[model samples]
Target: MDVPADDDPFEAQRERASNPMRRLFDEYGRERSGTFAVGVAASVFARVLDLLPPLMLGIAVDAIFLNESEFSLPLVPDRWLPTDPETQFWLVVGIVLFSFLGGAVLHWFRNWGWNRFAQYVQHAIRTDTYDAMQRLNMTFFADKQTGEMMSVLSNDVNRLERFLNDGLNSAFRLGVMVVGIAALLFWMNWQLAIVALLPVPLIALFTYQFVKTIQPKYADVRSTVGQVNSRLENNLGGIQVIKTSNTESYEADRVEEVSGDYFDANWGAIETRIKFFPGLRVLAGLGFALTFTIGGLWVFRGEGPWLFTGTLRPGEFVTFILYSQRFIWPMAQFGQIINMYQRAYASAARVFGLMDEDAGIEERPDAAELVVDDGRVDYDDVTFGYGDETILDGVSFTAEGGDTVALVGPTGAGKSTALKLLLRMYDVDDGAIRVDGQDVRDVTLASLRDTIGYVSQETFLFYGTVRENITYGAFEASDEDVVAAAKAAEAHEFVTNLPDGYDTMVGERGVKLSGGQRQRLAIARAMLRDPDILILDEATSDVDTETEMLIQRSLDRLTADRTTFVIAHRLSTVKDADQIVVLDDGEVVERGSHEDLLATDGLYASLWSVQAGEIDDLPAEFVERATDRGARAETDGATTDQ
Candidate 1:
């Protein structure tokens, strides 16, 4: 659970989830066990059958061609063997052909089984990982980049598929080949078999070194991929700003820097890997060369040779050479297997780490569906903070059913944060927010959120038709209802004027539409929700004066019978509220009707005076408030720059 310092990125990142590959199998592989078993079984069967051809060829060479040894197979009974040499020859040919045909069939099954297993696991992991990610609290995403998560879902997952398909397949096939071939080699002649296997221990030592050295390098490479992706996504999303500011060269330089980091990290891993694979081939070639030289001398002398003393037949010597090559080939391929495994393990570590992120919004086991009777909302001494900075503290207010209460405040007065708590966006550090005497935390999140509608200052619209964005949450809304909601938000006129009307493509983030058009659509979507409580956070702040009046009229109808909490900087929007709560620095500064607050000559009255074009009549207290806000802005700007 410990996070490393920024200076230590990969060494600790690789260790974030220890034995992640094992955990991955335990979590996702059990369900695909049947396919996995099939792949492994087919690979074992195919490799075993493949070894039979070389053994049969050796037998035919000696018994039929040279006639130096009798015709026999190790497992077959001697009586089953034909006395006719020509018949034995045909039998060898038949067995070799069957081995090829049978091995071919098994290899086909192996490929199918592995593909199914890898694809199934890939699909399930991606969907499940994404589900977990989306359900995590907003604070998790606030600290994460969209591209980093995309890398996990795309690049990291595809690496796992390759490892599972290629790595696991080669591992199983080579394993069986090495074991079956080694057993046959020693059976023919133990002394020459020893020379063939001498390189195995060296191969194993080199493989271990390769894995140890390449693991962190691969981890570094994976991290750099995420950074590069993050940089690209950030730049592309803000391409407008870059173009307007003419910062193309600056942004390109930043991209090149991150891309260079990726190249460096990848080349480091490639350097280690390329060196290891060739070293393995060398060891394999060494073992094959040693086996051929020793076996040839023994065959030439027709007697024992030095430390290796044995009677080696031309045919048996040929078989030993063939089996030794097979044995060493698998040993050589072990390098590739280890290389793939290290990459997969690094990717798996990142994936499992993401899955293991704590889901901050958890429903209590005994939580029940929320039922709104009167839509009465109460903020009773509610307090919340992020770390040491309290956004809202000891803020208490009440809006009885059918009340429209406006929250007016300075920029950092916690106006929006206070309303968000009513939706249970974050749990209160202390005290509670209740609706109809039910604690927001004690109700199911879905049911609680279903009873509330929100229209934020910053509107979000997915790339879709005008109708699709309206019915986003209300997916089953009829055509009539969609039109009525759009009419209610004053969006019908602009939408109908568009080329495609209801079917128009909004483009990414609704970029094709103007800000006013997007905000009106957001209001329409909220109207379709038809919740017991409504939140309007600067809903009319972005529209023109004419559009604002039109939307304001619609909002009056929208908030008529519902309990509405409006956060607005424009004092005109809330001049007719049932009650106006003015806040300053995370605390309530005033609460009253607009006319009554103006009579008090406090912060609300001052903010109203400035917005009302009463600049010459600004009170001394208003000037002080402006000075404090300016100071806060500067401090925040400095922190952002750092």
Candidate 2:
């Protein structure tokens, strides 16, 4: 597995060590400030109200049944409010009921606030991440797998939502309960409160250790998830090949390998998590048991442990026991909070890291739209490479508006590289490509791409209706326009014969259609765009001879009065081209008309003679050179496989 240059999962631990919440809120939370504030306030108030029932129980135990009414409250005399035993009992009951009702109402508002916050943030982050991803340079995508990116957008983004909803909600609720109960215990009886709090440090230490151990494991979990997803996606995408090669068992074993890795990684994290929560429970149970033993001794045995006297009251003891019991979950939930945070922390690094990657290709700030009266394209001293290996060096050419310029070359001779440079798919390492005398780099990307139409050797069609795929780039095209373009590309007859005509669904990558049919649809798409400059890269290679003749006629009319650059291996396709440019080793070796190149009896002449099935008529050296070139192509392919 090659890690993307933009992402390092091992460093996720270091990144997660930073404040993920702060980074997330800074990037995505500020805009929802008002909503978030409301949600937090609601959670706080709800938790506070929830604590009232327990306190009311203590009040009832002390005042109504014991006939003591010993607790004090400011600004109210005992006689002013229910002083009779029966009235006092009913009053406490009413207050408890009211508190429950109030807590319920606040819980509803809290849920609304948090859910809305979570949903909005989820939608925003996913969309923003996708937008940022689409704007990145093609090289970034070339280095990263589609499934790996999808995992970030879908799984990783969903994880953030889970943390924001469940983790944050539980954290606030538990914090309020622990703090409010602690305060009440100390105020009631500081002597026993100290005993109750003895386990706090131990729990904290345990939780800290758990977090430290689990952080790296969670990061591994996230990485393994991406790998598993990548493997599944790769298998599905290449299912056709797998079936054709009868390698289903091999692919299944590959899937099992990645799936097992995911299972092992996830199980390790689960094992640590399982150990952590139970350990926390034991610590909490110990604290509860200790408080019960000492408090019970002070009351029952008439002796406080290492204290003045057994001054502990029955009512206060009940309150202490209830508060101690209540402390159990928050303590255990602390481990859960840490668990969710670590998972979210790992996910955030990959998501934000992708967002931080810079797009290498961008137009100048003051770039202007290209206005083309004539789509004259010029590639001047262009040089480019993938890393240190140059694909095209010092390559230059001119295609006057409306002229048909055919590019013919051997496999590694840079025909496709030159066209890609014209499209600005990559920036040239040296010199420039200009359209209508304006430097392409100085023009807005949208405008530069809008003027050129491309039909690739491998045509891609979306899984949609035929009409939709044809008008993908020109979405506003009416039925008449779509029909005209289809007719012009000689695709109308076969398309209308389909089960649903133009409305028929072309399955993924147009797998429902034959190769020739796909190519014709691609030609129709370019025709619909009506670009001033047209690029055809082996456009007719997939079609039969009759269909090729029909398409050639349509292309002849489509290329009229437009800047056309054609790349073809079949010499017949370029026979009528106004000028022919032959490339060898990334440099131009010949330039002339077809007949003139044939007259020169050079490389083009030998290739033309070979294509004409006149290999015996070619010179012995030319035949030897052709055979050597074929051998080199095979050797290069093998090297690439290695």
Candidate 3:
């Protein structure tokens, strides 16, 4: 299982976008092409409203200055107005009210449209990313940490949300503000307009450099944050281990180290901002001073329009200043928006990388449903590995209908890997596994898995009631059926004694239950499934000897009429098995019936001797009882022989 290096070309291109804010817009572009159109329209309308205040000021100045040049409709004749000045004053008031109402309406529509688009895009991305996670294979989960996945689903998605809610629409509106103000200034007086904009290029240059310097820093901050989160998640999941080993201090130190790295990363980003933002503020101040100094002097000296007509009106200067302020505010926000976009881009790259992973096991286009009849399973020359080291080397085995075959091996001897291959958790590197004489690869994954019931050494129970955990596989099972399954697995007594009986909620991973209880519950779950093929991978290894006996009895009944594959270290558990295969170092060293393998003096004999010696080493009372049972069996055998 050499994890392949990611080589997506588009990943680099997406990483290099000048405005990660634009990427947010592009993500929106996926669902409805009309989102961008609506967004743009709303932004333009909002900007138009922003420009109205300046225009109103300019109009008011004209009304106050030249008596005959008062603000009035050019298409309307003066004779249509009332003779009194008071009547005309009311008309102007009505006009102002209408303008305010119009602005309010545009504001409502703009916010409504943009927010709707943002939510739609967020929903689409979340759904798509979740689906992509499901489609990925075990390899992806193996390589990726759980915390990093959580970060993508929570933090990264929230980053995108922030961009949509404010950053994207704000940037677009800012651009509109800049362009509209520039146009208005030019229309008023071209020379003054040029003077007002003289410092804009310098402002933009400063912002670009500031953002560029901080972008990589923000990426570092995000990475360090992810590392810190991973540490916390790992520690929390293994809290019991830490407590048992008295390693809380060690765990805390590790977490502190990661936290310190995060602090440094964030400080580095802040340092960049500390230097760049001060310079940006100074640049803005200089622009403001220039606007006031140059524009004021020009008006005071009666130049161009002022010199040709009269002194510059107070209202006009006020209006120009207001427009100038509007332009500058967006310039200040420009750096902040770029900062946000850069962080989002880094997050997006990680998220999309997960979404882009290719599943190692994929169904063929023409794959068919697995049809189970005789329950025959075959492993043909299977060679498999997790990485460079091989786990199963040209291994071959077959189990026919109604046969109980046991695989006994040392740790990491590829027993569980063989069973996983049958379930197609990972495809064999070089060989085929067949169910009912059909290649498992050619059968649909769902159908293949449905035919097999597996109970592993590690039992995973979700957070739910006892009844819910037992019926996890067969959800439609009636209460009576569930109880029957539990009885078969020897879990009924313990479950009935619980505080809530069937309704007792199992804590995370069934942590509240003892080891033996969890194993029994798992067996009960498998029994409910009632698959034709059963795999018990060290299922009773975690339980006490007393509990193991009960579980063994349940398993004996369950495997009586089915094909079973048992992987275990306890040799006594499989002495009655139809056949036993002894595996060591990725190859089968010996395999036969219990009595025959013992006579061979091979691996099985060596393992059986060790386990039998342990059993014989028990207390004298237990040994005497076993001897009495053996004598009784021999007496019965002699009578039958006669």
Ranking by lDDT: 1, 2, 3
Per-residue lDDT of model 2, residues 1-642, tens digit only? 322323433243335335656778887888887777777888899988777777777777777777555643334586677657777778778878888899889998888888888888889999988998998877677766777889899998999999988898889889988998898888878889888898899999999999999987887778778788888999999999999999999999999988887788788889999999999999999988999999998878656766635477677788889887887668788899889998988888878877777777888999999999988889899998879878788988899889999999766778888888888888999999999889999999999889999987789999999999999989999999999999988899999999999999999999999988888888889999999999998888877998789878778877988999999889899988989999877788899899999899887888888788987888987777667878987876632100
lDDT of each candidate versus the true structure: 0.88, 0.84, 0.76
Give the backbone clash total of model 1. Answer: 0
Q: Output the TM-score of candidate 1.
A: 0.95
Model 3: runs farther than 4 Å from truth? 1-28, 32-39, 65-68, 72-105, 304-311, 614-642
Tell me the lDDT of model 3 at 204.
82
For lDDT, candidate 2 versus 3, the one ahead is: 2
Ranking by TM-score: 1, 2, 3
Candidate 1, residue 519: Cα displacement in angstroms equals 1.8
Candidate 3 residue lDDT tens string, 152-236: 7777777877777677778888889989988877766666666677777887898788877876676667666667778899999
**Superior by lDDT: candidate 1 or candidate 3:** 1
Clashes of each: 0, 0, 2
Model 3, C-alpha of 543: deviation from truth (Å): 1.2
In model 2, pairs of residues that clash are none
Q: TM-score: which candidate is best? A: 1
* Each candidate: RMSD: 2.8, 3.1, 9.1
Residue pairs in collision within model 1: none
